[model samples]
Each structure stands twice: as C-alpha cells, then as structure tokens.
Target: MPIYNKLVRDRIPEVIEKTGKKFHATVLSQDVYIEELKKKSFEELEEYIAAETGAEALEELADMFEILHAFAAVHGSTIQGVEKIRKEKEQKRGGFNERIFLVDVED
Candidate 1:
C-alpha cells in the first residue's frame, strides 16, 4: 500500500463490508475535524517532548505544520495567509537554531 493516500467516508464502509470484521473507523465531520486535529496535534507534541525516547525532530515538526495547515483551512485561511503569518512571526520572533546544543550537569 502506498503511504499517505487520501481516504473517504464511503470507502470506509466498503472496506468494513469486504473484510467482514469489526474495526472502528472514525469519520470526522467538518466540525469534528477541526476539534480532533487540534487534539491530535497536542497529543503528538506530548509524545515528542514528554516521553523517554528521542523523537525524530524533523518528522514531528512536519506533523505539527501539517496539522497547523489543516487548522488554517478550517478557519478559512489560504496558504498565502498562513505563510504571511509565518513570515511575520519569523521576522518578529526569530526562527530556532538548527544546532541542538546541550549542557551536561555533573553532580
């Protein structure tokens, strides 16, 4: 199967019928899509920052922007609008350093 294929509500039911197995598939309505996207974004961040193992910083950061774009759409903002805001923020509050520098403390 190809990664990152688009799915629809009807295909979900068709899959269920063909498989003959009970699998829960969530169909996010327009309203629920927004709410769920926000919740999922935070959950992913928590997993990245508040957990034991190291999370791929690039992958998680991409996920954050993916959800943020979805959020922009939900609120009727275009990509240009989002980009403008991003640039504004970058100019006002600079971007992060690419290097991950850490100081170790000795006991």
Candidate 2:
C-alpha cells in the first residue's frame, strides 16, 4: 500500500472504494483541517502554475477558490466577505492590470 499523508477531497475515499480497493483514512480535527486546507491552497496554486491548457488551468484555479471558501468558513466568514476585502484592497493599492515589475527602489 502506498503512503499518502496529504489531505484529499471529501469523496476520495468513496472513489477509492468504488475501485474495489480498501484504503485507510482518518478524520482530521478542526485545527488540523484548517492547516491541511492552507497546505492544499499552496498545492493547488502550484498545479495552476504548471497547467498547460486553458481548461486545466481554470480547473486548478477553481480548486484554489474552493479552498479559499473553506478557509473563509473556518474563520467565520463568507466568500462574499473575502471578496469585499479584496475589492477594497484593489481599490486602494490597485490590481495587476498594470503588470508593473519593480526591480529596485533606491534614492
């Protein structure tokens, strides 16, 4: 049996069982669940970076968004609240539409 210590989607065990193979898994505590979700966010971001096709990239991006929603819920907030914060930051600092790259700032 292969070892997998990473977090997985909710239906992973069910999917594995459907393959006629037995797998072991544990339910994480609330604290551990939040930590795992944070890790999963990074994993999904890397996947989005490596995606080649538009559809694949969009899928990965969606996965990251889902994780974000989970994080928001864990923190007693909603996705809409998160988006409001983001919009506020964008309004104040601006978004990436400029694509400006700052190499150095010395005076």
Candidate 3:
C-alpha cells in the first residue's frame, strides 16, 4: 500500500486495478493538471540526463516531447503551433547545431 502523490499516465489507474489492489485516485482540475505537467516535464528531463545509454535517453526524450504536446494542448494550442513557434525562434536566434559554447563577454 504505497502512497503516490504524484501524477501518472492515464492508464495507470486501470493497470493498478487489474492487480486487485485498491487505490485512491481523482481527476485533477485544469490548473492543477498544468502545474503538475510542468513538474513532470522537469522530472522527465532529469531522467533523460541520467540515462546511461542512447536508447534510454531517447526514450526519456520521447516522454518529454509527449509532455510538451500535452502542455501546448492545455494552453489552447497544438503541437504544430508549438513547432511553428520553435522554428521561428530558431530562424531568428539560430539553432544549436553549431555547438558553440560562450565563455565570456567583454565590454
């Protein structure tokens, strides 16, 4: 009977029930959901950072991408819209393909 006070995938409750273990769960409000999504995004990012292999990192990266899509949808936008915005930023500021690391700035 472990207590989990964090958010989980939508099917998690159903999976838990299949094991004949009683669980307490409730739907979150839109505001709460967004807040939790933000936290979940960071959790996933940390997981990606701690991943030991390329495949593991890619899996965590996919989780982060899913969270991003959900975040955009919650904010009354779509993943396509978010991609458009990202592209615009990349066009203006340039992408990280250069792998440039800034060390210092002098006046």
Model 2's lDDT to the true fold? Answer: 0.94
TM-score of each: 0.55, 0.89, 0.94
Encode model 3's per-residue lDDT on 1-107: one tens digit a residue: 68878889999988989999899988999999989999999999999999999999999999999999899899899999999999999999999999999999999
- Which lDDT values do the candidates have, in the order given? 0.69, 0.94, 0.94
lDDT of 1 by residue, 1-107 (tens): 33322323356667767988665456668977767777778866875675554457666776677777777888899767989998999899777766655598799
Model 3: residue 99 alpha-carbon error in angstroms? 0.7
**Residue 2 of candidate 1: its Cα lDDT?**
32
Task: Give residue 85's error in model 2 in angstroms.
Answer: 0.4
Prediction 3 global C-alpha lDDT: 0.94
Best by TM-score: 3
Best of the candidates, lDDT: 2
Among residues 3 or more apart in sequence or in different chains, the pairs in candidate 3 whose N, CA or C atoms overlap within 3 Å are none
Cα miss at 81, model 2 (Å)? 0.8
